[model samples]
Each structure stands twice: as structure tokens, then as C-alpha cells.
Target: MDKAMQKVNERLTPEGKMDVLSKWEVHTLLTASKERFSYEFRACSLAVLNTGSTEDNAKAVLEQYPDFKIEVIQQERGIKLQVSNAPAQAFVDGEMITGIKEHLFSVLRDIVFVGNEIETNPRFDLEKTEDITNAIFHILRNAKALQTEVLPNIAVCWGGHSINRIEYEYTKEVGYQLGLRYLNVCTGCGPGAMKGPMKGANIAHAKQRITDGRYIGITEPGIIAAESPNPIVNELIILPDIEKRLEAFVRMGHGVIVFPGGPGTAEEILYLLGILLHPKNKEVPFPMILTGPKSSEDYFKQIHHFIESTLGFEAQQKYKIIIDDPALVAREMRSMIEDVSDYRRSTSDAYYYNWILHIDKEFQLPFIPSHENMSQLELHKDQETHLLAANLRRAFSGIVAGNVKEEGILSIEENGKFQISGDEEIMTPLDKLLSAFVEQKRMKLPGSEYIPCYEIVKPRNLS
Candidate 1:
């Protein structure tokens, strides 16, 4: 270890959100050295320590601080963190940065809570759809994410963490428009498109004197290391996985605005479309807008073409695409939110959570994204649109895992590349869409060459 790397032992109190831990939980956390929690805690802690860093490579970040270690220390009053060879960026003049300290404990709080209460507790039946939603609600409630007093103003922004300057600026402009209308922001809690909205919203909120603006970030364990929660996120909630994280965004926000992004953004769009396509959810009003700068017009065109070719007209109708018009995008979203408000009010649904939306069990279940699982997905168009969307969602989920996730990366290294075989009609457009993403440099950050983590194979036709 370097001389500057110092071992710091201190007892810290939880900041705004988390405060106390049960004795059993404290003991479990304190003794989480050889288990998954230790690995998760260390990776998440390192990511928090590496806040404000521009680099997005998780492996590189880990390599930089190979010796940095964090351990849980149990105490009579909750617990404390014992950090060894800790990053100096997280500390100043012998004291840890207050925000970073709070984030560290927040990680501990969520991990323990999820592992013990949600996963192990028989009360939350993970197999059932309602049970899964309940589990998500409990996790968010534990994080104090949902507010009863707040109106329907949270705009969930979805886009690539690795975006160009033009796209990033465009996201900011849209965010500024949203902020001008007193709307708050939520994102995947990463950089690039995610950070851009919050950054722009912050300035606009200040100008409008909106002091209580919420910049919420929702993330899961697998991708947190690669895309560390951006510094602008005042409220952070860690879902158990990507599926729950996506669900949380839709349930909590009144509207969604998608900017130019890669497979992950595509997955989000499909997920939302799948829900909207369900017969029960068709009447439930939820606003979705896809917008970008003029430069990104081609990107949206490709995405639109892909959706039309795959999910058909119904999926395409769920969202409106606006090019280079931030004000109009915000105005449209605001107007649609009013409809959402009126509909929810008439239906007696809670303003904080959209209880009316019907999310199918297929979408709720956690996808393992293994080689066998990826190959076995039902990608034919003969089924219901919503069911097809669920399968398509899983396909993208696998691709997402193969791209940046540690397990997926290792799988690719060992097993070559994941192969996706489906109907020729679907495979053709899917290949073209994925090819466009690769061509436009949306698959990974600029300057990093992307070796495809998936192969799209066409199905055999017996004519």
C-alpha cells in the first residue's frame, strides 16, 4: 500500500436517512468478511470513495485501490465502519467527508436490510408479483424515499452514462425546462445523461428559488461500481437488482423522459411499453417522452424503427419523440402529468405510488442472464405484445450484464459471447438496431472499443 493510504478506525452516525440497526443485523454485518456482503460493501464503499471521478471503468477503479478495505464494527449503539487503506479523497484533515461517510453507512443499511428482511423474511414472498412489489415498497420506505406530501412532479430521466457533450447539454436543457416548472429529477444515479439533468435542474431550481428540489438516484449492487452514484444525488436508494430499480423509477415518478442511450435505455423503454401494453394498464395514464438534440435524431430514428419492427405500433404509440425542443418536451410532459393526476385522483390511487399500474410477474422476476437462460428466452412474436416485451426485456438485460457487470464480463471471457437466436423477423431488426448502437458509439464510453457481448442469430425456417 502507498504511504498516503491510511487505516482509519472511527464510529460514525447515520446522516439523514439511516440511524439504527438491530443487534442481529449488526452482528451479521460485522462478520460479513467471506460472504457476498463483504464483497458488495467493499465495492460500493470504493465507488463512494471515488465520487467525482470521471473514470467509469469499474475494473480500473478497483485496480487503483486494491488494498483499500472496509469492515463493519459492532457497537452497543448501532455500529461503526473500520476502513483500512482507505481512499484519501473520502477524507479531509483526518475526518471523513460527511456526505461520503453517510453514503457508506447508507450502503450498509440497505444491504443488511435487503439481505435480512426482504430476502429471508417469509412475509415477502418473492415468487409472487404483489409480494415483489411489496418488497420494493418496503425497501424504498426503509430508505425514506417516498414522500406523502409531495405532488406528482418527479421526472425520471433515462439515458446512457456515456454520452457525448451535445447529448449531455441537450439533457441539461430539458432538465432546466422541467425545473422551471418546479419539477424534481430522478435517474439511475450515474454520470453523463443521468448527471446532466440533475446539474441543469440544480441551476434552474436555484434561479426559481426552489430550495427543496429532489435529485433522487436509484441503483442496484451489480452496476453501482461501474456507474457510481453521481455526487449530485441528494437521495440515494439501492434496489436489490436492476429489475426492481426500473420498477421503482416507474412507480415513484409521474413521468419519464428518455434521452439518447444504449441497450440499457432500450431495455427501460421496452419495460415501460410492456406494462402499458397490458390490457389492465392501458387506461392508467403515464407520460413518456423521448427527446434529444438534432445530432441524436438518427439515434432516435433507429430506436423507433427497432420498436416498430419488434413490438409493433402499440409500443411506438406509448411515447412521443421530440427533436431539439426542450421546452416543448417539458410542456408536453407537464400536460400529460395533469392527466395522470386527474386519472389517479378519480381512481383513488396514491399520488406517491402508482398502485394502478399492472406489472406482470415475468417483468418482476429477477433474470439470471446465464448462457442457458439467454439462449432459452422466448423471442417469437406469436405471443401477446406485453409477453414478447417481457422476453425482449430479458434479452436486453442479458446484454447489459455482459457489457459492464463483473459476473457477465467474466462469463464472456470464459464462454466467448452470448448467443441470442429468435424469429428471423425479430432477429433482423434486432441485429440492425444493435449494430446501429455499436456504430454510434452508444454501446460503451467513447475511446473504449466495445467488443460485442452478444451475438444475434436468426432462426431456421422450415419451408
Candidate 2:
């Protein structure tokens, strides 16, 4: 821990959205670290207080401030949070930053609600796919994420948290253009590409006098500590897992714009492609764009080549690649999403959520990236292309876990790197694509050398 990273003590009452809590809710929030839900709520709370941290490693961040503690105190009128040894950056002079405070309470809000209402309630049957989708809808509805009056304007941006200065600037430019068109921005809500768009959109919203510009950040507990909620996020929702988070993005946003990123970005692309490839969703008018700066053309090219090699040209046809033109990216998205609006209107689907999109249960189920499970992934081309994309999505997802997630990193430490073996056809392209990510420094931030967490293996021919 740097000695300069000061700690502060404060007791705060929730303001704005999360001002009140029941005694039972307050008790659950207070005892988060000691119960069935594990230490996630506590860890996420700490992450909220440590916003603006440049460090990407979750384990390192937690170890650095081992003494930090947060407690929820119940009151007759409401509840209060007592935080000790919180990172001083969340404060100015002696008061906590208003956004950080709101985020902290939001963490508490989601954790408690998920634990009580979704997990334990008998009304929700998690085993059923429809029930899972219902749970997500309820969670978003509870958080006020769904707005009935608003037209389709939410654009979900996917990209790497570790990006170069040029790419980061390009993201902001694209974001600025989107905001000028009165489009709201939603992202993973971390640093690098995730934060860049929100930051840029804020300025444009200010210029256009758009007061209620929504900057929604959706994340899951497993990766939240690594990618803490950036300060610009006015609406932050923590889904139960990565699969649910991906589903939430697809179901909520009208369109998607993918920026240059590492395996995590690949995971998102594969996930979306898998959903789109399903025969049920083939006609769904979901606008997809892959855009970045001129320097990033090769990055998109490698991604495109990999997709062509594995999923074929039809999968490649699902999205368009536009490099070095932020204004064009925004204009194209604006024009394309109108088609989305028209489709929904014609089908009588809700504007706020995409109920018409059919996602297979395979994509909805959470995949634990344990070594055995990772090694068992069917990376061969024998399966349906959509199913293959799901497996490929899981492969990239496991890599992302090993790269920045604490448990995955520790697992790699305990038992070497994850062994990913597949047909030569897949391994060759997969290895080449991952090599490009490392070469471009997309695996980790600029200063750190990224040690790979998975090894690509090509199986030998059997005579």
C-alpha cells in the first residue's frame, strides 16, 4: 500500500435513491461478511469506496487496505453506514464524494435485495430459464433502470479496461458524438474504455443542457472489485454473475458498439453472436458496430479473422467495422437503432426490454471457470455454430477470469495456467488472436507485463 493513499473515517446517512431501509434489510446488510452470501457485499462496498483507483488487480487492492471496514447501523427512521479506514480519495477535504456515497449505498441496496428477494424467496424458480429472466427484470425494475417513457436510446459499449491513450481518446470522441444525439451511455463501469465513453458523454450532455443523461454501469460481484464503478456512473446495478450481466446488456440496450479490448471483449462478442445466431433471434434488429481509432484497425482485423475462421462469414456479417471515425460511428448507430425502434413497435415488444430475443439456456447458465471445466470445453467445429460460440465465449471468459479476477488468478497460481486444448483449426487462430492482445498490451494496463493464465493446446492426430 502506498503511504500516500490515506484513510478516512465517516458515518453517513443515505441520500437520494437509497435513503430508507427496513430493519431486516439493514441487518442483512450489516452482516454481509458473515452469512450465506459470502464476503461479496463487503468486498463490493470496499470497491465502491476505493473508486478512481488505477490498480486493476482485485487481490492487490484488497490486501493493500486490509484494515478498511464498513458497517451498517440500523436506525428507527432509516439506516447509517459507518466506514473506517476508507481510501481518502473518495473524500475531498473531509467529506465523502457524493457519487461514491451513492454507489456505496447502491452496492448495499443490490446485495441485500438480491440476497433476500431473489435468492431465498420461493416465488423465483432459478432452475427455469423464464424465471431467471424474470429475476433480472425484477432486479432492474427495482433499481429503476427501466423507463417506459424513454425511447430506445441506450447504447452498450464493450471494450478492454487496459487501453492506450489514443484508443481512450477515440472512445471519448465517439461518446461525445453519441451524447450530442441525446443517446445515453451504458458500460461495464470501470476504467479505460468503460469509463472513457461515460466521461465524454457527460461533457456533451452538459453542452446540450441534457440534465437527465443516464450513465448506467452494470457489473457482477466476481469482477466488481477489479473494475470498481467509475465516478461518472449515476446508475450502477450489480447482477448476480457475468452471464446474467451479459444478458442484461443485450436485453436492455437498443444497440451495441464494441471498442478494442482483450479476451473479455471477445467473450462479450461471442456471447452476443451466439444469441444472434440462434434461429429465433435471427430477424431481431439489434445494431452491432465494432469501432476504434486508426491504430486499432489491426486489432479489429484480428478479431474479424478469428471470427471468420471459427464461426464463419455469417457470424462476421452480424456486425460492421468502422475505424477512425467517431462521428460516423454515432451517426450509423443513430440511424440503425431507428430500425430497432421500428422492429419493436411493429412486434409490440416493450421499448425498455427485448423480450422478443431468444437466448438459449446454455448462455443463461453461469459457467464457473475452474480448471477441470475449462479443460472440458468443446472447442471443436462439430457442434452447431451457435453452440460453438457459447463454448468459445466460455473459453474467453475463463481467460478473463485468470487474467484479472482474484479467484482465477489464485487458481492459476495454485495449479499452473489453465490448459485449453482443441482441434488444430481452432487452436491456431485462437493462439494468434491472444498473441495479438498481448502484443497490443490489451491483456493488462500499460505499465504491467501480462502473464497469460491459459495455454492453448492443439491435440495430436490419432492414427
- Candidate that would win on lDDT: 2
For model 2, how does the per-residue alpha-carbon lDDT over 339-421 read when each residue is reduced to its tens digit?
99999999999999999999898999999999999999998898899999999999999998998888998999999999998
For model 2, which pairs clash? none
- For each candidate, what TM-score against the reference? 0.95, 0.97
* Model 1 stretches with alpha carbons more than 4 Å out: 1-11, 21-25, 31-36
User: lDDT score, residue 382, model 1?
Assistant: 87
Model 1: per-residue Cα lDDT at residue 392: 92
lDDT of candidate model 1 versus the reference = 0.85
Q: Per-residue lDDT for 333-428 in model 1, tens only?
A: 888888888888899898888878999998898999999999998888889999999999899999989988888888888998899988887888
